[model samples]
Target: MKTLYTLGLALVLTPLPGLVQAQASAEPEIASYSIDTTLKISTDRKTRGVSDTHGEPGLELTVEAAHESGLIAQLQLGSVSRVNYPEGNNLNAMLALGWRGGNPEGWHYGLGAAREWFPGARVDEAPAGFDASFTPTGWVNTRFHTSYLVAELGWSYLTARYLYVVSRDFRGANTATVCGNYLLVKLPSGDLGPALDCYGSAMQHSRGTQLLDLDLSYPLNGQTKLVAHLGWQRVRNFRGLDTMDYRLGLEHQRWGLVWGAELAGASVRNRDLFIAIDTDGTMRQMEKPKLILTVAKKF
Candidate 1:
């Protein structure tokens, strides 16, 4: 893969011992990582069989920072359902090579990929190959990397009636074949304000469309700082159980922390992927898309 080749080349191109010694003599190498803790406070959380007391709160923690090698490892701990691990309470990690010198340094653009697991990060499923003796077998992986071309983008704003949000979810299941959209939006952050699609509180992916979140945030300091949350959320259509997608975060001095709780919402007992044609000539869907609780630390 191109990504693999590029990473290999970057690592190999590092200057040799003598060259490194010269740079080190000029400036000692200094590296550091950060860990942020977040807490969640929720409202009534219930739908089908899953339910958190109306006032039940949740939590999660995420630690992600830059590396000297243009490589970054980001880890998130919370509750969400995955294909391989359906049980609640899981953690996830995504390590990638970042493009730090670009027009925007704070904007992380790089290579590499990620995997998911429960209680722990989801595992990287083995590429479809074979069993002992070359026999072929494996479950049809339905999330994350097993899913390529699965790019996502979303936007949300608080309004009087509801927390408005719209999103498009794409996945490249078979390298050659890509699956389409899953859209959703809840009314007023449902319960948890805004978490993320393919990222946080994923149990919210019941339908895959235009949905909203229950968002609440407040300033911890005057400027460039705050603590917020996208509580628990509803999956719009069938109204499955919602998770208390809560988080506590702070942003200041161009750096901060984001972490908290993530509970899983139950899947729709009865449902289907709703589809449509967008005004942009591309295929679109009236699906129930997922939401995200975002906290950025700038440097």
Candidate 2:
């Protein structure tokens, strides 16, 4: 994990020493860069019906660079803490490069490639009587060494994205594809407030999953906003594996700094794997209904 972080940081910080020089003198250079850091504190750290952080807080950092020619690159690094794996913090990193074009206000399209890495994740053996030996450990690792290609098209307030699994196998699947659609609308600042966003995704694979989300945001004042989210996820080919999640948050932003507090919860179903807690305060699965605090800065 340390090595991966070092390498990613190096790539992010290194300058394109000769590329710009090779370009034609008539062309102008338009470069932009930004750094964002976030601190997240949560009651439970679960994703996709699986607990990865065992109800703990996490931190993340992202850096992005882009050029007017539509080329962009991004690097992100984060820490994962699990109650069962207290010996070390699981580290994850993602590196992506892409190109985007078209008008932001009218129509736009983008194509990108991304590589996600998990260095400290391991496959755990199932407990006695379980048919499957390879179960995902609650260690913040999907154990997925994957590379994917993404394509997106957007017009006005609607956008669609498709992701193709370019790697031979991601996790345990040999091939997988996912498509997502989003709708966003700006509303008047009345009782219900200002914005509405809806998103849905369908994944194709042996154990496919479908996800849907609705988010609404209301402006409380000039610098504060109230946000609410409702989400549903269902796993195909498996009955009784549906889950519902919701979140309510209040955020304030000023001078490129943002802070928020949220209450979130999820319902567990029979198909979800149950994590057990031992007498020594060690937790195997995550618990639901989390309180979260977030602080972020963009530069």
Global lDDT of each model? Answer: 0.31, 0.52
Best by TM-score: 2
lDDT of 2 at 197: 10
The residue ranges of model 1 lying beyond 4 angstroms of the native Cα positions read 1-58, 81-85, 88-99, 103-108, 119-299
Predicted candidate 2 versus true structure: per-residue lDDT over 34-121, tens digit per residue: 4444444444444533455556676677777766678878888766553333333477678989998998667888889887776655
Colliding residue pairs in candidate 2? 44-55, 275-285
Q: Model 2 reaches what TM-score against the true structure? A: 0.55
Residue 275 lDDT, candidate 2, scale 0-100: 47
Q: Candidate 2, 139: how far from true, in Å?
A: 20
Looking at model 2, residue 190 earns an lDDT score of 34
Candidate 1 residues 103-137, lDDT tens each?
A: 22122233333333334322233233333453333
